[model samples]
Target: MDNDEPLESKTTEETETQPAPQSSDEMLYCEAEVPTPVDKEKAGRENSETDLEIEDTEKLFTTGQKELYTEACKLMGVVPVSCFLRNMEESYMNLNHHGLGPHGTKAIAIALVSNTTVISLEVADNCIMEEGTLSLVEMLQENYYLQELNISDNALGLEGAKIISEFLQRNSSSLFNLQLSGNNFKDDSAELLCQALSANYRIKEIDLSHNQFSDKGGELLGHMLALNVGLLSLDLSWNHLCSQAAMALSNGLKANITLKTLDLSMNGFGNEGAAALAEVLRLNSCLASLDISSNDISTEGVSKISKGLEFNESLKVLKLFLNPISIDGATLLILSIKKNPKSKMENLDISNVMVSEQFVKTLDGVYAVHPQLDVVYKSIQGLSVKKTILQWTNPMKLIQSYADQKEITILDFFKSLSATGAMKMSAGEFWKAMTKQNQVPLNRSQLRELTKRLEDSTGMVDFSVLSVAKP
Candidate 1:
């Protein structure tokens, strides 16, 4: 054959070797072909191996956790062995020591209650170190359920505190109460914590007692307090906070309206700090309780507080215990009480303070002078007389006559009338009428007869009988 004829023949052979283009239906049928039995078996075997591997890994993790827990329980000697397998909402095992080293404990803590809502773990008096605290903080950051955490007395120093502060800053945790008391957190740690608090609004209460927080830490905390509206209580007792810290706290208190209770006891808040706090108290309308006990507060400091008390009506409890407060301070406090007639104060503790007998006597006198004062005195016959004399300055002969009778104290008479049913009157109405009448005191015999008649008449006894002579 010629060369051109040979090439044409080769092209023809190539074309013949190429398969023809199939129709759309033929393509669809080819694509829909099912896998062979061997391929199906191979796929199923691979899937089964994957499932087994996953199950084995899970079993290994679980077994490791259980072993750790058992070891921890044995180390801590916690009785009634409580083991949680899954779904721990709020785990409160305060003071329970699991003998795991810091790392192991933290791992278990994170694993055991990884999905908890609130973790109140009190490792007080434990020897937890920085490494353990860091691990715990990492777990906290990863956790979504934990809200309130109490890790007090873990011996975690500034380094550990810093780690926790980092987590607090990043996590939008539901944690509201964070107690770091007895942790020896110094100024740096405190500042870190305050920074975290300022950034995070979830925490409501922070206890920093028994730490080394000095003026710097106090200043930071105070600044945070000024801006934070969520915090309700702040305890900085025994922190060596001096006048500088007190001044900062005072400034913060002026801006803060949500904080109701503040504890500054054992902080050495001398006259300066006390005066600063007093000023804050004068302006604050929400703070209900203040504890300045065990400080070096003297008469001057107390005078400042007393001055504040004159303008403050919200403070119901004031503690000035273990201070150098004397008669002068007491006198000032009594005067403040007198000036502020609308004070709703329930208790005032100045115990262990250098208060003079004269101060007590003055307090008694002031107590006697209050318009709503109720003085309870015991008689020689062991009978208690509660006399709530009104502030009526007018001299009425009828009241004098009743006072001379000395039959019963005003409270006793009212109580008897109430018990006898003669005073079908409600407590408010009876007090109103009694108050309106100026409480004409009656002699024991007359009071007794009145009560008896009141009982006999079921609170409907006629008062006209008192005008008649004795039978």
Candidate 2:
């Protein structure tokens, strides 16, 4: 045998000493380890090549071409045909790189086509002056398709914010989202934004977080929520919003129905602010998630929120991260969740709050209960004999089938029912009456005719009962 290799005799002896293959049952007990494929080195090389290609393409855009594009954008509407650059058709035309001073945006605005569907434009990190911002606002008023415009991290003061807000009020542009984060927008700017939101309903999400929006801004936003129903999410986190602002917002929540998600995290909302929000939660029925994490909310605030949860059924997620909630507050929350059947909260983020092991155990116990309940006893109970039968059914389904034959909603069907005084009583009472009177109900043809007449009339049915029955 070679010096580097094991001796052939030794190898043969080792093979002989090894155990033989076991029976099928014993073999089944053995676990197999699969080897992982090794292609990481090859992937690294491929990524390096792709990065090189991207760098090479970026180098192809000459400084002169960029300047030409910038000049073309600046002269957009000023010279009519000057805005129709061949390169602008490809992507966003950046004019700030041409060293055109603070008025660079104005140049681009003057060149842009009115009624144009420019999807995105970035003028951020540049010192665009107030006059330049106003010119851009005018451009926004005429243009329709600009969905996103990032002017954050710039020196856009309250004046700039107001200008943009005013343009936003009139522009029926298909802009659904706006980000003005990191701008120094104070209370006045916030008020302008609120007014803009009230007039314009297309924007669904607004990021006013990280601004200098104090109590005044918070109050304005609260009032705006009462009128603006299209907005689904609002981010006002990291603002200097205090208790007064929080209270105003809470009051607005009482009337607002469409808002689903609100982020007020990192705001300095203490116990009083939290208490105000808790009161709003108790009354509101549409909000599903609220993030008040990283605030100065103390145990007293948490206690208020726990009390509110006893009545709140719509809220699903409540974030209280980094709050000062102690064991007592945690215990109260656990007890509330256990006692309240209406509390449908799925997520309770209490991370960093001081809670005891026993409180955690109590919360776990609450989770252990069955989701549904069964009543074993009632004040009155009845039994039937001799094959006597009764059935409880949804009368709406029967009416729906009749309406479906003619293609109409239950509202239309009820309208026709009113002319014949068929719907004089409440829908529940009418349904009960129908069940008691009809041993064998009307034929399909007769039902269809009844639904058709209901659809023909301008009568109305009271749906207050049905509305109240909804969870």
Query: Which residue runs of candidate 1 sit more than 4 Å off their true CA positions?
Result: 1-91, 96-100, 114-119, 142-146, 353-471
TM-score of 2: 0.56
- As a whole number from 0 to 100, the lDDT of residue 323 in candidate 2 is 83
TM-score of each predicted structure versus truth: 0.60, 0.56
**Per-residue accuracy of model 1 over 1-471 as CA lDDT, tens digit each:** 011111111322222322332443322111112124312321122232231121234543564443444333222222112223221334664433433345334434545433444456554554557755665565555556656666777778878778788877874556677888888788888888888877776777788889888889889988988887787778888888889989998998899879888888998778999899889878999987788888898998888888888888777667877788666666687779778876655446765544444554665556544422321211222223333123222333344445458664433444444446352552223433443343564432233333344333333334344334242
Best model number under lDDT:
2
lDDT of 2 by residue, 65-149 (tens): 3333333322221111122233345445433222223344554554443324457776655566676576565656555666766
**Which candidate number has the best TM-score?**
1
For residue 5, model 2's alpha carbon misses the true position, in angstroms, by 61
After TM-score superposition, the amount by which residue 4's alpha carbon in candidate 2 deviates from its true location, in angstroms, is 58
